[model samples]
Target chain A: MKAIKVQALSKKYGEKEAIKGIDFMVEDGEIFGFLGPNGAGKTSTINMLIGLLKSTSGTIEILGRNLETQKEAIQAEIGVVPDESNLYPEMSGIDNLTFCGSLYGMRKHDREKRALELLKIFQLEDVKHKAFKAYSRGMKRKLTIAAAMMHQPKILFLDEPTSGIDVASARQIRKMIEDLHQKGTTIFLTTHYLEEAERLCQRIAFIVDGKIVKTGSVETLKASLHDQSGLLLKLDQNMANLKQSLQEELKLTKVEEINERSLKIVWPPDQELTPLFTFFRQKEVHILEAKRMEPTMEEVFVAITGIEHSEEKGGES
Target chain B: MNKGIALLSILNKDIRNYYLKPPNISWGMIFPLAWTLMFVLRSETEVDLIEILPGVMALSILFGTTSMLAVTITFEKKQKSFERLMLAPVSLYSLMLAKTGGAIIFGILNAMVPLLLGIALTGLRAINWPVLMGAIILIAVTSTFLGLMIAVAAKEVFEAQTFSNFFRFPMIFLCGLFIPIQELPALIQPISYVLPLTYGVDLLKVAVGAEGILSVFLNFTLLLVFSFGLFRYSIHRMERNWMN
Candidate 1:
């Protein structure tokens, strides 16, 4: 079953289009990642899908129902963790979780027990009694996520779930997301962290300038980049005719002078590396070191979008 | 049934998080008590507590509801906590009801202090207990709804407070609180008809027999209309601001 389906979804802000007719879907129990930079309309799409903002055009279906007319029913079964950690500042961690459960109509005892369970899962049990205002940034993020899951929703939308947190917390949040997926919950995650998306998402979509430039699984995206090749070599000496000779002998496409001692070359997927090694040896290239490069998600992002991948270290801060 | 539970939960959190706090109580009490004190001090003869009771009670609801709603809504908006409530399974009506309901509860409680104090110290009494309750309840709802309208229009806490004062301060002087409506200039008399506080105070006056500028039925009808009208406007503003 498809947990979510969006078709020609568009949002316009006066003279500017924020999301220009994008289409996508998330299957039940699949972790689908929407990857983009700031102002790329990632949050706009999420907001529309969750019924917070009405789209200027197109339609959305969630949990086998129309998003426009069935918002309350869809909302009941879908948990959302917005980018901001927005729990009540004065309420304790346990109280915040319980309050969120109460919003979903959980019984008092059930909410209490669930709050305790989630507090423990998020490693917030020790500080459960402390006011949310007193929590560290990382703890606050974890608690916000915990509150979202208090009702055990079947589908979850996490917008930068691990943003602005310490590395340990980010890792814990990622692990929790994996656990949620393992437990059969469909997930829609939007993030700027290329590595996180690469690690967790079964399928990834690259959105740029209010449009989806590419969408596929990690392997599929990498496979699409197979035609574009990259290789790295370290040498003791810089050859004057390196680019020309490599082009002539090994049919190398693009050669970049990385540094004083390193060079990067683009070779076709069909081209054999043994010929390149032979060409280097024949040309008296020192060839101190050599490495074959597989495209990183960051590289894939930069290639498809023509935008440099400059996310904050450890996600968002 | 489930939505009723959710509504109570929202009310419970609001009361526990905002209304029950000492600072909130003190803030609500300070404004009305200060006004009462100023009236008592400036009087030439013995202060007629009954004469000013309606004004004090009306102002209590106005100040209390506006301040509470403005602060809570702006804070929730800034922190993004209100989104969670909007995303809940309950209707926007339920959420608005819970928020305004909480503000009304706080306003009534805050108003009670001055009313009880004046009754105890100056022997003021309500001639019709049911009418007094009806007037206060209706005023509380109207005031809270007006406060919500201001809060929805504002993006920040200070903005909410500033916008509230723009409406509140004008009503204080124009609503026949300190000066009777008949004594005001002929030109400004029509403005009192449009201000909900005028009807609110009149209802209070009729209930306690201080003076009835308008009949009981007229006062209740106007208050009811204003209450429902303000409520409709607030909900419209909220949907435009958030649920769009």
Candidate 2:
């Protein structure tokens, strides 16, 4: 059996659905990315997988064990790093990790050794004796992941692991994630940063409004955009407005913000770019450069989630 | 790998992080001391130290454990630290035990403050040591579990304390803390019997050689029952809260 097998899982909060009957699987020893915009049920799905939230309907199987019935058994072999740092703030970094190790039933000697090892592995050894609350934001995030890794679980679930941290720390964490993946831990990663998923995930699932609209290898998603191609629109100044305008005005499936001053617009090979150029000129936006490019994962995400149909389109100003 | 270690781990962490914090330590010490001073000052003549000893000790355990446990649990939840514990491999019962263990210890310690004070004031008398120990443990257990239930009932710390006071203040009046249950207005006497703390103080009364209104065996049995009932209910509410 796969490491994670979520089948038709759903979660309801009163009258609203947070996770709508979504299904996916994480192959053993591969990084599986669950990608979505905010409020797309990513956290809900992770909560269910980790046994914090029960599914209203459907099944979740972790390593062939039913999540509902075998939660403790499954929990014994799985570790999770939530978006926020949940370790005890007043405790030192080492204490927090050892405490986590103990929760997984690690012996005191072994818990201590593993906590020390993890503190070093996550580059938290320098602050190992420092109170968690005293550590910098990046250091705190690292300690949290170290705590999760203390038990040496077979699978690791990281939810927005790099969100709200400094760039250098995010880079370090991403590298650590790759190292963990290389060491044969099946990783279930949820992230909004498509670039990170493109770089790390072996297979990705795109969830929108609680439903998964796409699930396949990065290559499979790219393959679907065969007839389509991306047009990179590099501007003189940052214009988040340009991406929104393009998506709304053209009703295009893929117009993404590549960075502050650039957008990638995807369309069929036969579609004319002249109209977009005309629209840019009319909006008094200077195009620094425009180049043809292969369709990126952003295109696949937009194509899959069908963001073009998203309502309340910003009045095309 | 035993669950025993995990229980100890959580208890130790809670003691270090919440109960042993200087603010909490000060608060725990002040409650019993302040109560001792208040009643002492209120006496027009000589203070009857023995008469108020059991009441002060019971009140200390009740307020200290309930306030401290409710605040710690709610704070952990708000900070998402409790959510981390909930994800641990331990069974729910073990987890709950670990969570309340710190408060139980604190409750017993709070009772000790008044006991020592009483001893220092009146000179240690013919106190039944074993019965006093048992009563202290029972009261601590019952109060901690009651606090757990109140914490489970509310979302935020303030709400937990408000809900906690709803039960705690009534117990002070009805649980024979300041007044004998029989001397209270007849209409409120039944409320006294229903309170877990009342049974606890009754046991304390007998332990201290003061005549107890209820049978000693019945008081012990009722306190146990109340502790178990509150514990089970807290777990139920916890699971319910955890899901959504």
Candidate 3:
């Protein structure tokens, strides 16, 4: 069964459309990444799927149940870790987990057993008795995720799960995501970390300005932009007139000087390199190293959206 | 059946997290005890302690339930924990009942100490124990619903407290807690009829064998209607701002 299916889904706030009739599907047991910048309608889409926000138009089917009519049944099967970590601060970690489990109708012994097992898995067993207020930020994030998992949900939705955390904790969470996927848990993840999405998601959708620009596997996206890709060369010595000389000599429109000894030149993916090499040799650029620049997800995102990675954080194109 | 379990779980967590604190218990107890003590000590005329005892207990329940419900909702909203409840598999009805139910239970528990103390120290006795118990439940539920209503309109804890007092303070003066409703000025008598606490206080008067503005059946019916009406209103307001 498909974990989630959304068609013509839309959301409007006042006069502005937050999600403009976006459609997508998350296959069961796959890590489906919703890749977008902040306020790019990623949150609105997730909220609508989770039954928190009313969609302006369209239909959503989660776990084969209609979202509008069977929200409670769908909610029972899916776990959502919102953008915020919001466990009760005054309660102990165990207490919070137990309480969350109880809401799912877990029996006492079963709830306690599951809470303990999850605490150990999350490496929170040592501090299980401490109030949540005393927990570190990463620990709090983990606990919130753990709380969502207390009911052993069929699907999990994580929003910015590893953002703004220490590197060690982020690494652990990434590993955990991989582990969960391997164990046949369907995950619908939203993130700004392009590299993380590239590493984890089997398929990803790129959202910009409330619309999805592309949805495909990593290899497919990278191949799509291959023709516009560039080659980077590190020269033995600095060439003062390299930029002008390369553009004029090689008939290239995009040649950029990278510091003193490096130059990047764009060419068609299938173009021969011999001509460029001879051209550089004639100019005495004296290439020390040459390598093809396989586009990172960040680069693919930039190429598709025409927005810089840094500027994307502000959420406005 | 599942909703019942979810409701109980929510109530249990809320009681542990917000209601059973030492400060909450003391705050609920101190005001009524202090008020009753001052009234008894300052009276020059032959004071009927029995007549005043019910008012004191009613005030305790009123303040306890309303503040607990209002403050907890506002705090949960501010901290974003209320969204967790929204995401749970429980129905909205179960969630609302659980939240207000916790406040009602705590209010009744807080009232017991001051009530027993008054009965022991001042020789106060209930003429109709069942009516008194029913009145207590009615008042607690209605006041807690009022608190939830205020909470849905407020984004901050302080704002909720301020809005709750906007209703609570007026009811204290106009509900015949301190002075008889009939003795109030002619212009303000209509205001007493509108306030649910006026009916609650009248039922308490009936419980203690004092002459009340309304008959026992009338007060009981009015309080029930007010409680049900206010609870429904709170549910409506909550649906409008569920995420906020």
Candidate 4:
């Protein structure tokens, strides 16, 4: 059974349509990424799937149960790590974990034991007795994720798991997420970090302005943008009068003048580069650097959605 | 998962997190004693402690319940921790009951200071023990639910406090806590009957061998109606907010 299946899902806050009839599914045991920029409706869509918000239209089936009818049942089997920590700040980390387990109906002894194990696993055992409010931002987030794992949920929904944190903490969380996926758990992660999506997700959906613009694996997303294939040339001297000559002789599809000494030639992937080299050599505008520009997920994301990923511009907090 | 455990889990967490904090404990302990002293010092005549006991107890429950609701409901809503509780396996009704359970218990405990003081001054022989216990429990439940009603629409802890004071200060004057309901103007008597604290304090007065306008049956019945009505209405409103 699919871990989640949402069809024609929409959420409206009065006249403002937040999620405009989006459709997607996450298969069991697969890590699915919902990639988008801020205010792209990623959080809204996840909230609806987790039953925290009711959809204005359409249906959500989580673990083969209708969310509208079996919200508590579905929720019992799924765990959500919201964009914020959402755990009690005044409570100790171990206390928070055991309390979360109790909400899932675990016995006191069992919950205590599980909480200890999780504390050790999450590398929080040393400070398990400290209040959650006393922890650093990274530690607080780790505890929140650990609390959500108290019941060993089959499917985990994480929204912006590594959006704003120290680099080491982000890396640690990514490793932990990879570990969870390896242990046969299905993960549905929403993030604006395109590199994270490319690294962690087997399938990804690009959301923009409350709509699903594209959905595919990392390779497919990049390959589909192959029409943007081009050769980049860096020159030793300013293009001077050579820009017109190269454009006219090469009959290039498009030439992007990157700087005084460089240009991007949108040549077909199948086209030969020896001719361009000969043209450049004849003109003695020595080719300092010449190569195809491989598109990163960041590039594919910007190409498809027309919105830059925040992390790409170092705008992350 | 067994839902009873889930309900108790939320209750247990809330008690540990907010209700049992040191400042609230100190407030609960000092509120009744301070009120008792004020009442004793105010009256030039030899004041029978039993005559004013109902008012002090009712006010204690009111303050205790409303203050805790500010922490349990309004604060959790602000922090989004309540959303985590909504993800639990328990039903919405059970979840709300668990969330307010701490405040109800606190309200009852708050009344104990005055009850002990009353016993020391006037002795337990004059008090109707069974009816008084019922009255205390009913008052706690009804006031806790009333606090829930105020907290549902509030976005901040201070907002809950302001809303509670708006209801609480008026009920102090109108609920026959100090003055008889008949002494109030005819226009205000109808308003007195509508306040939940009116029935609660009247029941307390009846249990304490003081002159009370309402019968025990009517007091208990109205308190029950207000308790469930306020609880159901608050839960309905909160459920909408939680889901959205």
Go through the candidates in order and give each one's DockQ: 0.68, 0.60, 0.59, 0.76
Judged by DockQ, which candidate is best? Answer: 4
Docking class of 1: medium
Q: What is candidate 2's lDDT per residue for A172-285, written digit by digit as tens?
A: 999999999999999999876678889999999888899998888988888888767877889988787566777888878777788999888776667887888788888888
Question: Which stretches of model 4 miss by more than 4 angstroms?
Answer: A234-264, A310-317, B42-47
Over B1-244, each residue of candidate 3 has an lDDT whose tens digit, in order, gives 2666677889888887777787886787687778678766765533466667778878888888888899999999899888888888877877888888899998787667666776677556446888888888888888888888889889999999999889899999999998788899999999999998899888887887877777889998998898888888887878766632
Model 3: clashing residue pairs? Answer: none
lDDT of candidate 4 vs native? 0.86
Q: Please give, for residues B1-244, the per-residue lDDT of candidate 4 as tens digits.
A: 8888888878877777677889888899898889977876764543467778888888898899987885568888889888898888777888889888989999999999888887876675778887788889999998899889888978888998888888889988999887789999999999999999899888888887876787899999999999999999998887687676
Candidate 4 at A36: error in angstroms?
1.9
Tens digit of lDDT per residue, candidate 1, span A180-209?
999999999987788899999999888888
lDDT of 4 by residue, A1-317 (tens): 88889999999988999899999989999999987776778888888888778899999999999999998899899989998889988889998998899999999999999999988887899999999999999998888999999999999999888867888878989998999999989999987677888999999998888999999999899889787778898988888588888888988766878999989887768777898989978987888998887677887888888976654443421
**Whole-model Cα lDDT per candidate?**
0.86, 0.86, 0.85, 0.86
What lDDT score goes with residue B231 in model 1? 84
- What is the clash count of model 1? 1
Candidate 4 lDDT at A271 equals 74
Q: What C-alpha lDDT, on a 0 to 100 scale, does residue B213 get in candidate 3?
A: 78
Q: Estimate each model's TM-score.
A: 0.94, 0.87, 0.95, 0.94
Candidate 1 Cα misplacement greater than 4 A, ranges: A234-253, A256-261, A273-275, A286-290, A311-317, B40-47
TM-score of chain B of 3: 0.93
